[model samples]
Target: MFKKLKDGVNSLKKKVEEKTGIKEEEIRPEEIPETQETDEKPIDKDSDVKDKKTSFKNKAKKFIKERKVILSEDDVEDPISDFKFDLIENDVAFDVAEKIGEDVKKDLVGQEIKWREDVGKIVNESLRNSILNIFTSEFEFNRYIKETDKPVVIIFVGTNGVGKTTTIAKMAKMLRDKDYKTVLANGDTFRAGAMEQIEKHGEKLDLKVIKHQEGSDPAAVIYDAVEFAQANNYDIVLGDTAGRMHTDVNLMDQIKKIKRVVDPNLVFFVDEAVAGSDAVERAREFDEAVDIDASILTKIDADVSGGAAISISYATKNPIIFVGTGQSYDDLRKFDPEWFVEEIVG
Candidate 1:
């Protein structure tokens, strides 16, 4: 999915080596010998010769300890620029790309590189740490759900066609599989067939669905679901709201109303991984409007660039808790930052 970013990193490695004449492999301390053999004297029993050898060993040790490879500003300038362009071309937000470039420069410029160290590996590690820094909140989704109190209310929000409804169903199935009594609330009464779609999933999963007629107030449906969960002892309530673009002020306001009425424990913003930077912008806007607790990216398996997955959490300052991998009830997978970095950089 991150083919472009990976290629760009490889290019950066080559450029660094080309510009600095530095080999990719690092030199180890043990590789340096303590002394060199001399043809002048083979004094096997001479104490003076032994003392000379010891002195030579100490000098060599000191030299090796003091030696370090440092990259100058000019050494990294061109490579960082090229890599920044590469990130932007791959749909990374300009600000994010710039931040990565600056971070790489900070880590590499004037930093010591072992003589036999893999320069590429060092750069890659720096990039990985920089990217990981962008993730502010991370948690195990299943554990969080299980640990929360009974009838935990989770509201799903996103733009149209990001697979919000289907993702909700997948989440419901996930909870149900864990033996949590779940109920689906179709708060998306403004959208045609939204109720029917969620109801169909409910039937398939043998889970109950709470809904109201189309055009009815969305908040009322959620309120009913919450009350029902309280009364009937359901373990979780997965509420689905109507999909709307960030530009739709009215629909955004409706989401705000739902948030007010439901007081959900968690609010997830659903998006498509293929949406790239657009998804990041939408996440920002939605978060501004409703303060989303986390994100759920859909169609990740189909996204080639993987920019959205990389940038959304960073841009919105929210963690991505789950990802929709395919078109199945069990396709939703928990997000792992380390696994994602490995997939992109390994």
Candidate 2:
């Protein structure tokens, strides 16, 4: 996982080391004093003082030059520029890549380093810090659910073919494992078989699903589900909305209506991680419309670059609640940014 991103960062570090010439180890003076000399030629008393002074000066200059190497902005400019291109090629959003490059450049410039290994270590750590800063919010979904009020309503929204529906089913299974009394609500009335898809999951999970006929009011469907949960003491309600792109004004309006009616405790924006920057843009649009509480990314196990996860969290300033790693109902895992950083940076 994240193999491509790791390789790109490692390559950038190597370039920085090469461009700055920090890999060379300087020879030390071996504690030689002005009076010490190994030369076989006899030292002439008249010129001995002058010769020793000149040798000491040369040693002092070499020691200072080697020990106090400082990297300048111009030294790292080309390497950082190349890193930005690598990021964009690996599906990082152009704006995000630019921001990350500038941050790394700032962190590296004018930094003092000892000769030998410090240069590479500084560059690598700086890149790691830059990426870690992108994951601003650290969230744990199960912890939040355990503390929040019962009968919590969570609406899931995303564009088409992004696995929004399956994600809801996985979430239902996850809640069941936690021993929460959960119910599924099918608000995706526009899709021809959307109702059936969620219904099938309900049957498999042995949970009740509230639904209205296709083309019926979706908001009412979720509202009814919430009411049922309240009456039955269900712990949570996971609502599925019709998948629609940001460009689809009508569907976007309908989604907004669902949020308004349900007043869900949380709104989760689901997207496939493979979509990369496309997913980042979509996440921003969805959050703006409905004010999403968190984000859920699917197909993470198959993602190569892993830029979408970083970009989405940075773009929305919202925590990444979960990521779908596999096809099984139990494959959903809480998103941990620290673990992600370790995998991508180490």
In terms of TM-score, which candidate is strongest? 2
Cα-based lDDT at residue 165, candidate 1: 93
lDDT of 2 by residue, 1-346 (tens): 7778888888888887766655533434454355544342335757887675555445344544465667888889998999899898888888889999999999899987664556667887887888888888876677879999889899999999788888999999988988999999999888999988999999999989999999999999999999999999999999999889988888888889999989999999999999999999999999999999899999999999989988899899998888999888988888888788878777
Q: Per-residue error at 281 for model 2, in Å? A: 1.5
**Alpha carbon lDDT of residue 170, candidate 2?**
94
> Each model's TM-score?
0.85, 0.86
Report RMSD (Å) for each prediction in the order shown: 9.1, 7.2
The 10-residue segment with the lowest total lDDT in model 1? 34-43
Model 1 TM-score relative to the real fold: 0.85
Clashing pairs in 1: 25-116, 26-116, 26-117, 27-115, 27-116, 27-117
Best by lDDT: 2
Deviation from native of the Cα of residue 325 in model 2, angstroms: 1.1
Clashing pairs in 2: none
